[model samples]
Target: MVIPIHDKNPVSRAPVVTYGLIIANVVVFLLGPIAFAGPDPDAGRKARENAYLYHYGAIPSQLLGGAHGGHGAPVWPAFTAIFVHAGWIHLLGNMLFLYIFGNNVEDQFGRVHYLLFYIVGGALSTYAFAWANPTANAPLVGASGAIAAVLGAYAFLFPQARVTLLLPFLWFLPLRVPAWLVLGFWFVMQLPEFQQTIGVSSSSDVAYYAHVSGFVLGLVYAALVIGRGRGPDDPLRLRQKAESEGSGTPPLAPDYRSADPDDPYGQYHR
Candidate 1:
C-alpha cells in the first residue's frame, strides 16, 4: 500500500503542534514493549495482550453492556486507547496520517475542540467495534479510529486539497492526488467490510468496522460541530466564494497581515 506523506493545502494555523504529536507517537513507539505489552507474558498471551488493549482499548461490551461479552461496568478503554498503538509500524502509520491531516482539523475546531472531537470519535469507534464484535476477546489498540475521524473531517473540509503519497511499485515514487479521491475511496472501501461482517463474529484480527464507523462519525461530527464555511483556522472560505462568484479569479492571499506592521522585529513579525 502507498504511504501518505504530506498534503497540498495544509492548515494555515500552527502546524508545529501537529508535528509534535507525530513525534510523541514515534517516541512512544520507540520506547518499545515496555509501554504496550500486556500484564502477563503467557496465558493466552496474544489474547491477554489484547485484553489489556480491550480493557484499555475500545471495547463495545464495555459501552453497551450485557449482550455479547459486554462489560456492564464503566468503560475506561475509550480514553487510554487513543494514545496506545499496537506496534511501531501501527503507531508510525497512524501518526503519519494524523500529522498530515490533523492540523487543519485542529485549526477548524481549535485545539480544545479538536482534541475533544478526537476523543469522542475514538469512543464512537470503540462503540461500533464492540457492537460489531461483541464476543471477540481480541485487544484493539492504535489511533486508527481517531485518525480515521480526522481523515473524514479533512475530506469534507478540504476536498480539493492534494495529498502527497509515496507509491511503491517498482520503487518508491511520490504522487499527488486530491484529498477527495483518496479519502473518498478509503471511506467507500470500508463499507464492504462492514456489510460482510454485520452480525457475524469477526474471525479476522483487524477491526475494520471501527475504522469505517469512526470515519462516518468524524464526517457527521464535522458537519454538525464545524458547520459549512466556519472553520476556525480557515477564513478563506468567504473570500474563495466571493472570488468564485464575482470574477472566477483565484481566492485572495490568506490574511497574514500583522496587527501592527510597524513592529518589524517583533516575534509575530519574525
Candidate 2:
C-alpha cells in the first residue's frame, strides 16, 4: 500500500475553498456521532450514525429512481453524501487528499469554480455509482469520490509535480515520486474493481466505479478548462509589466509555471 503524505508543489493563492471543504467534512462527521443523543450514549451514537447514512447518504437504488429503501428525493443525499464519512480513517484519508491536492486545483480555477467543480464532481460520482449498480440498496457515502476528482485534476494539471508517498513495500519509507506515477497507479488499480462491479461479480462494499468516474470527469474538466486558456493567473504574464520596464527581470524564474502550459517540458521550481 502506498499512502500519499505530502507534495512539493506551491499554489499561486490561498485555497480558501479547499480549507472550507475540509472543515465542512470534519464538522459533519463530528455531528453524526452525537446527532441522536439519548439515554444510552453509545447506542444513541450508533443509531444516529445509521440514521444519518440512511437519510443523507446516497442509496444507489434510490438515486436511480427505484423503490429500494423507499427514501425520498435523492437530491439532498446526492449532495450531502460527500460530507458524510464512515469513520475517522475514512474522514482523515479523504481530508488528507483534499488538503494536499485541492489547493493547486483551486488555485488554478479560483475559489468559486473550484467549489462548483467539487460539488459537481461529487454529484457525478454518485450518479456513476448508481449507474453501475442501479439495484444496489447500500447507502454510498464519503468524500472519496469527490477527492478522487481532485486527484484526477492533479494528475492532469500537475503530472510532473513530486509527491511524497510512504510505501509499505519499502517498510514504510518515504519516496518522492511524480504525481503522474502515484495517481496513475491508483486509477489503474481501481480498474479491476470497476470491471468487477460492472460485471456484477464483486462482493466488495467499496464504490470503485465512483472513484473511477470522478477521476475521468475531473480529467476531462481540467482538460477543457486548460484548453480554453483558463489557468492559474499566468505568473509570467502578470509580471510582464515590471519586466517590460526592465525591473531586474521581476525577481522570479521563468520555469516557475503552471503544471501544463504551452511548453510542457518547462520544469516547475520553488
Candidate 3:
C-alpha cells in the first residue's frame, strides 16, 4: 500500500487556511462523539453521537429530495459534514492528507480561493454521493471528500513532485514516489468502487463516490485555473511545453525542481 507521509514540495507562503482547517477538524472531532466513548461517557454520548450524525452529517436521501427522517438541520449538513469524522483514525487520516497536500494548493491559489475551492469541492462531493445513493439512509461524514479534492489539485499542479511513502512491509522503509503516479493511481483505484456504488440501494458506511467526485471537481477546477496560464509553476503549460519539445512524442515526465533560495531542501530534479 502507498501511504503518503510527506511531500518534497515547499510553499511560497504560509498556509494559514490549511492550518486553520486542520485545527478546526481536530477541535470538532475532539468535541464530537469519537473522543468520548468510555462506559460512563457512552450512555450520554450515544445520544449525542446520534444527534451529531443526524444533525451535521449529510444524509444522501435528504440531500436528494427525500424526507428529513427526523434529522434536524438538514440543509446545513452539507457544509458541516466536511468537518465531522466518525473516529480518531478517520479524523487523523484526513487531517494528515490535508496537512501534507493542502499547503501547496493553498499557496497556488492564495488563502481565500483555496478556502472557497475546499468548501465548494466538499459540497459537490456530498451532492455527488447523494445523487448516487438517493434512497440510502446513512449519514456521510468526514473530510475525505474535501481532502481528495486537494489531492486531485495537487496531482495536477505538482504531478512531478516527490511524495514520501511509508512502506510498512519493508520494515517501514520510506519510498519517495512521484505525485502523479501516486495520485493518478489513487484516482483510478476509486473508479471500481464508484461504479459499484452508483446504482446500489443500500447504506454504505463510506461514500466512495463523494471522494471520486470531489477529485474530479478539483481536477476540473485546477485545469481551468492553471491551463494556458503563463507561469513556470503552472503544470499544464509545463506539460504542453514538454510535449512540444518532444515533437508530439510523449516525453518522460520531469520532476519539479525547486528554485527558491529559502527552500532548505534545495532543488530535487528526480
Highest TM-score: which candidate? Answer: 3
Model 2, 1-270: lDDT tens digits are 578877767676678899999999989987776333544568656776677788778988788775535346566677888999877777888898898789989987789988999998998999999998988877899988899998898888778777878899889987777889999988876786555665745437678899999999899888888536743456534455555787643444232323344533333322
Each prediction's total of clashing residue pairs, residues at least 3 apart in sequence or on different chains, is 5, 0, 0
Clashing pairs in 3: none
lDDT of 1: 0.67
Model 3 lDDT per residue over 4-35, tens place: 77787756568899999999999988887767
* Regions of model 3 farther than 4 Å from truth: 38-43, 66-73, 193-203, 231-270
Worst 10 residues of 3 by lDDT: 249-258
Record all residue pairs in model 1 with backbone atoms less than 3 Å apart, i.e. clashing. Answer: 50-139, 53-57, 60-130, 61-70, 61-71
User: What overall lDDT goes with each candidate model?
Assistant: 0.67, 0.78, 0.78
Residues forming the 10-long window of minimal summed lDDT in candidate 1: 251-260
Question: What's the alpha carbon RMSD for model 1?
Answer: 7.5
Show pairs that collide, candidate 2: none
TM-score of each: 0.74, 0.79, 0.80
Point out where model 1 deviates above 4 Å. 16-20, 23-55, 66-73, 192-203, 229-234, 246-270
